[model samples]
Target: AQSVTQPDIHITVSEGASLELRCNYSYGATPYLFWYVQSPGQGLQLLLKYFSGDTLVQSIKGFEAEFKRSQSSFNLRKPSVHWSDAAEYFCAVGGDGNNRLAFGKGNQVVVIP
Candidate 1:
């Protein structure tokens, strides 16, 4: 069985401030972790992913994630956030040998200018 958990339900940050969203996952085999962002009333957009090699992967809109197998955690970080970055972010783990993914409840971010 596999599951993802995002400890933060909501986060608020001022424009140009740093942001970090926590994510933890449980998987039996090699885990494929991903971060997806969804704007208000919009579909989810792929942020980044970590499958193999290098611990870090970069995605669209200045987002990056690091995967730690030992800690079973894949946290998302942005050096600086813009007001338009406000969205609901989800952390997901891919099924072993399958394309299916199990996503967390999501962390909602609010940006203030």
Candidate 2:
């Protein structure tokens, strides 16, 4: 069985501060990892993905993630978080190119001025 778990349901951070979101997974084989950001009442945008090769992958909007095979984790990190970055983040695992994705509940991020 493959599953994604986001331990933090919500996170609050001051604007312009660094941010990190944790993601852990359980899969029988190598899984396709992805991080998506969803604004309020909008569709998800792909933050990054880890298929193979490089363990460290960069995404748009200055977001980056590193795949740690030993830990079965792919954590997201941002050097500086902006007010606009305050949105729901979801971790997903793609299964067998079926176009079906299993997503974590999501982590609500709050940015304080």
Candidate 3:
């Protein structure tokens, strides 16, 4: 079984500042990693994902994530976060043989001026 852990439970970042969120996973084989963001009254949105090939993947809204197999980590980063970016972020791991994904506790991001 695969599992994901997001170390930060809550994060506060200033508007226009860079933001990074840590994610670690434990799986026997190559895992499918995903970063999802959810805003108040909105459904979960796919930010980025990793399956194979490139170690780094880019997504919508200027979000990117790098997959580091050696460290069992897939961290998400944004160069300059906007107020709209303030939301709940979740890291999930699955794939290979697993059909279902396991998500982390989630990180609540609050953007301030």
Q: What C-alpha lDDT do the candidate models reach, one value each? A: 0.92, 0.90, 0.93
**TM-score, candidate number 2:** 0.94
Root-mean-square deviation of every model: 1.0, 1.2, 0.7
Model 1 lDDT-worst window of ten: 93-102
- Model 1 per-residue lDDT tens digits across residues 19-109: 9999999999999888999998899988898889999888778988999888999999999999999999999999667778999999999
Candidates in descending lDDT order: 3, 1, 2
Can you give the lDDT of residue 68 in candidate 3?
Answer: 96
Tens-place lDDT digits, model 3, residues 70-113: 99999999999999999999999998768899999999999999
Candidate 2: list runs displaced more than 4 Å.
97-99
TM-score of every model? 0.95, 0.94, 0.97
Report the lDDT tens digits of candidate 2 across residue range 1-113.
Answer: 67899988999999999999999988777789999999999999888998899999998799999999899898999999999999999999876654677788888999999
Error of 2 at 26 (Å): 0.6
Report the candidate with higher lDDT, 1 versus 2: 1
